[model samples]
Target: MAMGHYVNYYRLEMAQQREEEGEEAGVKRSAQYMALLTGPGFTGHVLALILFLMVTSSVERVRRKGFETFWYTHHLFILFFITLMFHGAFCFIRADTPPYCKSSPGSYKFVLGSLFFYILERTVREIRARLPTAISKIVLHPSKVLEVQIKKSSNQHGDGFFRAKAGQYVFLNCPDISAFEWHPFTITSAPEEDYVSVHIRIVGDWTTAFAKRLGCSFDDEQQFWIEELKNRTSNGVGGGEETISGVGVGAASGSSSAVAMDSMAFGSGASLMGGAKQRASASANSLQLQRPTEPTITLPRVLLDGPYGSPSEDAFNYEIAVLVGAGIGVTPFASVLKHIWYSVMQPTKIITLRKVYFFWVCRDRDAFEWFQDLLIALEEQNLTGFLEIRSYLTGELGKEEMDTVLMEARAAAAAAAARHFRNKHYYGGGGGDGADVGNQGFEGKGGEGDLLTKLHKPLGGSGAFPMEVMLGEEMNGSNETLSDARRDRDAITGLRSPTYYGRPNFDKIFGELALAHPQEHGQVGVFFCGPKPLGKTLHRCARKYKFKFHKENF
Candidate 1:
């Protein structure tokens, strides 16, 4: 009886273990299915989450302070949390499925690891807010731009100068009695250089003061003579007697510039008194204790935000690249050109890029002169042969000139489309299904034939009558045909033919470049950072030429 009982117990244990394994397998399968659905196929879900967040936030703000103040205090956290939860769910589902699990256990581990990193990144940002202030010193002094240099730093041995890409900008802060105010200035230095610099045009209120404060003068100058006379009288023997004598001398030198110079000389006296008074008053004002001394004009505390941009090295792989900049739009391309030069010319890893064209539109020579040195240096490196620079002045692009440019661009696009169509028919195997080839076919009737052959037919490719095509015929046709067309007349009359107007033909540029350097390998990638209209035009043109385009907005 004891032996039989032990045998039964062992069998029961085995059965329980098998049941646990089955449950574990189901859990894994569920996780895997979730991941696959969410990965690329569930983009709609992500968009829905975004919309939900937007609506929820709007509703919450309306409840808080009515619609008038809703625009000011809408918390963005509603949208942020919605997206976070959706993204997390997406990743969780992708890790446990059959196909995903068929790989080694290492793949599952990687998904978990990425999730860990995401959590850590958020945690660090949360802790950062409680940290101490980053800025150490603030200066509020006026400085004139006496000279500008666009060369590498002299001291390479130090912590290495902050390297900047061509078009990136830096913020400069000048301390005032109120609070620190910062101005953004573009860096003219290329990425390969050790140091960066900016060229500033003295046009603002601060710049004007800087010029007056920092400029030097000769003693023979009217202002200097008055300053010397004042010093002499101040030091003369007998205080009461000297005071009378100073008044007499001041009366004699009766010039406005002299009076202005004297005022500046006395300005230092007031500053000294101000400093002393600030020290005495510090105990009463707690805020003064946090402020730094030395009254710096050029603040040493600069906050660098980003090396922000898309991949630049990818441009080297393209056969043809076109860069267009209007005014300051040239900034991002500066980084691109620098990347190309280093990647192609470096001895260790030489990648031969084919051709680059740059078109810069500016109002005056001064704009070009700002970064002309860098352009000249690039030309000197014998890179100009591979690069074309065209400048269009404001007046140079009038209505007639713009019209011509647009026409040329369009013509180029049409020609490229024609070539692409020809190539597809001859070499690339014709379209698998008979479809409308440029405003030719209607829905439902499928045919199998060459596109060119269909284009030549008198019926113009489709039997299911196009509403617009029948409109003119019906208007002039017999009364019987008009009655039949009257039922659908609105649809026919409303239809408008597609026209290519105010559009850029990017196909011409891409096709010409491709033809010029057929030996160059890899896919064409076009990057554009500009105004909306220009970017849209380039995108349309790129599509025509079959080149990939990426656009970034400022």
Candidate 2:
């Protein structure tokens, strides 16, 4: 029905046009009709298809290359919108233009508010990105994990302290990195903590480059600068048109150069061509300027943009929560664990979370070192049995070797416990019974730095967490250090149960949780951030046992 009506309307229009423009002229105009194909409308339509391709074709590459292709290509949206505006406001075929269409003019007025808000939001974001953020602490961890701990700049943070929920994240930008790219990482510190921290695992291209920048020398940095500039051509900086237009422009510096740049930003045709020549010439001049002899400070200027909420942000809402992470994905739960730790220590802190089960599954043993200190400390304090952490190491090792690892882990725990006891005893002088369990106090993070260091102190064999069992010597020296009753000590640490050798049995784990928390028919918040496959398995388990499961992925 619609096609028949359009056909009749088209015939009427052609007949009217024939009468007004005489038959010969009307026929010639019909032959030349290509209104939508050669102007802004065509450009906008082409850009739409390009953007669709960008989103669809780069799906796999985005995962491997750290979103660079997606990030850079997505900027074409600016051109897309601009061309769309031009396309809508102008008309090539003018049959309806004299008294415009009654139904609608164009989409511009309708989207004005949305466009303005987006522009405002981006302007604020760019302003925030321009500020320099200081990294207060850099804790280099094993397994290529680098933690850049930064404090909120008082001048920049403004008003109150920078606040975030347990499982939120922030977008990080480093000028030395790409100047435009920002990556997201989970907030690993508690909201109440003085400093904010992001644990970056050296995995993708951007992270690897950042690691290089941190360790490179002065000469290496200069070389990197040249290479980085050259790479910018493909990264959406340099252009053939700019190079051509900038030809024969004068020096790299001057008022005329500034004028040329401004002209280039808004000019077109021959004027734009000349401006591009000037810009390219200026760029070449810049490349020739003598390098600073005194190496400029090489520390990359990093900026932060958000404390955006993720799915796991609501973990505190549920009384019974299960926080799970695998590999670097454990960062979100770190914040939750810290929060839970504080809640356990300070009984008066108002919070709904009564219990938290943290599970960290890793592929390498060295990865355990990242959170070992914090988790061990949590276990040593026993935090009223409110926090339970479970680590699964899926590395390839024999049963005997696995047993050795388990024994070593237990012994490590026992040693930490002894240290907690002796550190207090020494602080109280030699008068108190060092082994007195009633006097144990591991409530606050005040002495966190000294927590492990105090363990290194010689307690004159009064042995809080002792150096009696050295894991290094035992693991290397013999197969004889393995224990039969090592399973008994698995429950010793509140941080985690025994480190399991393989993957977890999700069905069994959820069943146990469901049984334990069934008294009030309470909901168990199963929060996870990890591989999609594991999350899917967890989702099935949640559905089977009637638990609410939430996950956040990058």
Candidate 3:
């Protein structure tokens, strides 16, 4: 009887537990139903789509006039408000839903749909805010023929400039002009530097205007003068044929070489030339050069946003690095090389790098001259042995010229090796037999000391190159001898052959490199930043070579 009573008590407890579970499940379902009714998930998504169309239509109108005008201003505020409303509605819905709702089968479907809407909304916002609105002080401004280097403050901590990896870009806002507009520029300085620098070439209206405003000489002034003339006519100079002719002649003549030279001298040349000639004609009947007494340069308030690019960490693991740079594309490589140099040469650790080849293409001697100092320093450090520096002067460099340079460099290297072998044999305790010592001496005796030395010495043989070669050869030999050593002690486990080529036909270069270095399949990475065609070609080549390609467009 007692056992039956105990069994009944257990049965009753089980039934009660089941009832509680059923009630809890019912409560959850009710909560979910309430959430679906109140939440803006579907409703908000529809509203966002409507807002996207509205914003896109408004953009065309905003762009037609000016991005800073009332139409643009009103559109921006309206878009912002709509986005906020949509965001708030979605948040309210998410909050009201039970946590278990997230586990429902339909949840993933909803999320996928919501994600698309989110991306679209965010993208539109980015397009609207394309112009950065912050201001950064100009740190350094260096003028070059093709571009100007403008260094400015960064978002990084401390007074020091942010360290940007190779291929990264920053958006600059000149608040002094319009706070809504921002221009993109790649960082050209080394990553270790305290200040960031960007090399900007005058290109479009915005860039050209910015360059002119920054006092870089370019064709922008002429274009600006033309634009100013058009503006005046549109503003209703209400005149007859004579007045129109006067304005046309004035604009044309004002943009002439004389005006350009005058502008360069006075710095206010654009403004002065842009003013109606009638006004100037009344002031003085004579053509005269006027220089502004006050400084004309008004530094724009600058703002920096983003350091976007592929990460540079990939280069750190590379045993051999080959950097191919065309024109200003060399900027990112500069940063990469700098990082490698510092990381490898740090006093606290000993990380040996095998080789780094830099193939730089330029248009003239002046182009080479720009980075000449940096190249010289690298060469002096014997870094050039590991780092081969080759320059192709594309403007005047024909196939023959390029071939000649390559031949000369190769012959110079071979001859130096031969002479060094002879010297070792003659001097004793060196690595050669004394076969050519007599011949060398005889050649040296013929009043050809300078010629013999030149022929015997390596190209750029100011002692650094030979020392580097010797050390490199020794290291290579040591690795061979230590092949049987423990893996931890192996220094050359993954040594790669050096890449040497001059003005390789871009069409076949990728395929050739890929075929020869099949092991590079997963290990190699390619970076291209230059003319669109060259960049595209490299991208194709990278695919053929089975290399990972990272491209940064300017």
C-alpha lDDT of residue 251 in model 2: 14
Candidate 1 on 1-554: residue-level lDDT in tens?
33453354455444433211354652322322332354422543454555555566577435333432333233443444444444434332233334433233233443556667867854654343222112221111111122222223223455433455544655443232102233455554467655444434444554343333323111244234333333432222111111111111111011222211111121111111111212222333211111122221221122232233443334555666667665555655766666665654664565545677765555432244333434544655777577764443342223432333233333333443465566657777466432334322212113422211111222112332211112112111211110011111111001111111112235555666567655642366676665777778887877766666766443
Enumerate clash totals for all models, in the order shown.
9, 12, 4
**Best candidate per TM-score, number?**
2
Which portions of model 2 show Cα errors greater than 4 Å? 1-24, 28-36, 57-63, 90-105, 130-132, 155-161, 216-297, 398-496, 520-522
Ranking according to TM-score, highest score first = 2, 3, 1
lDDT string, candidate 3, 55-170, tens digits: 66566555444434433344444444444444443333232334512323333443566557877865754553343222122211112333333344434454534446755777
Clashing residue pairs in candidate 1 are 32-96, 32-97, 34-93, 35-93, 35-94, 139-296, 140-296, 140-297, 141-297
Superposition error at 227 for model 1 (Å): 30
Query: Counting only residues 3 or more apart in sequence or on different chains, how many pairs clash (N, Cα, C under 3 Å) in candidate 3?
Result: 4
The digit string of per-residue lDDT tens for model 2 on 1-554 reads 33453365456446655322455453423312322344633554565676785776468656566577777777776776666666655444455444433345575776677779989988988886655455554454545677767766455436434667887898988776788888898889887777789988777778888766654222454344434433343233444322122211111111223112111110111111111212333343322223333322234557788789998878888888888898888888888777766767775658887787888878765566566546756876865468876776665443433333344444444555576677667766346565553234321123332211122432122331222221111111221111111222332122234555457778888887777788623558888888899999999998888888898875
Error of 2 at 124 (Å): 2.3
Clashes of 2: 12
| Model 1: lowest-lDDT 10 consecutive positions | 243-252
Per-candidate Cα lDDT values, in order, are: 0.38, 0.57, 0.43
Q: After superposition, how far is residue 422 of candidate 2 from its true place, in Å?
A: 20
What residue runs in model 1 are displaced by over 4 Å at the alpha carbon? Answer: 1-188, 196-296, 311-313, 339-348, 363-365, 395-508, 518-522
